[model samples]
Target: MATRNIYYKSKTGILHWLGLAIAIVLLDQISKIWISHILHYGQAIRITSFFNLILVYNEGAAFSFLASQSGWQRYFFTAISILAVVVIVYLLKKHAHQRLFCLSLALILGGAIGNLIDRSLYGHVIDFLDVHAMGWHWPTFNIADCGITIGAVLFIIDELKRVRKS
Candidate 1:
């Protein structure tokens, strides 16, 4: 017998998930643009004991990997984001009825597209949110990063549930 798709069928339209992705991209872009306008590069404003608003750019993947390279990293990351977007879109289209899985994919898709837009326009990704601790600062990130991180966690959870059910 052919193996069946493990996810439950749903009535949710793929368009709805795509809408969510578009909303995320809009919010991320708007926030980044606003931050860029309000804060000079490398500027930071303390928002709380452990939080900050800042404006910075990343030319590489997470944690500044390859950031020291001579500008080649920008196009490299852009290509990677494009590939990820294509894969995510394909999965989203194929699994539109899987609510949770599709939701996770939509989040990742939005994030990839958001950073892709940044790479295309600025050759870097805009990062603002800064979380810190006692004399230690985590790498600054942005809304797109949040979406991608949350989506990854949710994707893992959904997959674990699916595996357990099988």
Candidate 2:
């Protein structure tokens, strides 16, 4: 009689990664909701000498690109995010066993979905975190943006490690 190794075979599904993604989305949404409830649009609450909490509505991509354009950008961005989510899901499912790769995809998927929910519900994404120094202010962002940025960094690291290993 042969003994089956359940632990080895059970690592091939995306459920674990998907759960992480869902957690990120929930955290992003809850933070945004809390910010919205406490601050009026355009209100800035200084948290430190270099950091501030502000309410901003972004209608376009990163760094406010296309934000000034007529409302068409909302639907365009939403569609793009949806497509990205689908791709991420496929990648996650395909490489579930690759822990680092799946983790990167999960973070990106969560961020994308978080922004998608905002776009679908409010016609724009809510940004609250603000960083500034020496009279220069960085673009305001939120938890979703942080997740996406971190995920992108991790993805790069994973790729670099893979290339080096080969």
Best by lDDT: 2
lDDT minimum window of 10 residues, candidate 2: 4-13
User: Candidate 1 on 1-166: residue-level lDDT in tens?
Assistant: 8888877556787788899899889999999999999999999999999999999999888887998899988988988899998888888878888988999999988988998999899988999999999999899999988889889999999999999999
Model 2 agreement with the true structure over 50-129: per-residue lDDT tens digits = 99999999999888899999999999999899999999999988788998888888999999999999999999999999
Give the count of colliding residue pairs in each prediction. 0, 0
Residue 145 alpha-carbon offset, candidate 1, angstroms: 0.4
In candidate 2, position 16 carries an lDDT of 95
The parts of candidate 2 lying over 4 Å away from their true place are 1-12
TM-scores of all predicted structures:
0.91, 0.92
Residue runs of model 1 more than 4 Å from their true location after superposition = 1-10, 134-136
Candidate 2 at residue 31, lDDT? 100
Worst 10 residues of 1 by lDDT: 5-14
Residue 60 error, candidate 2, Å: 0.5
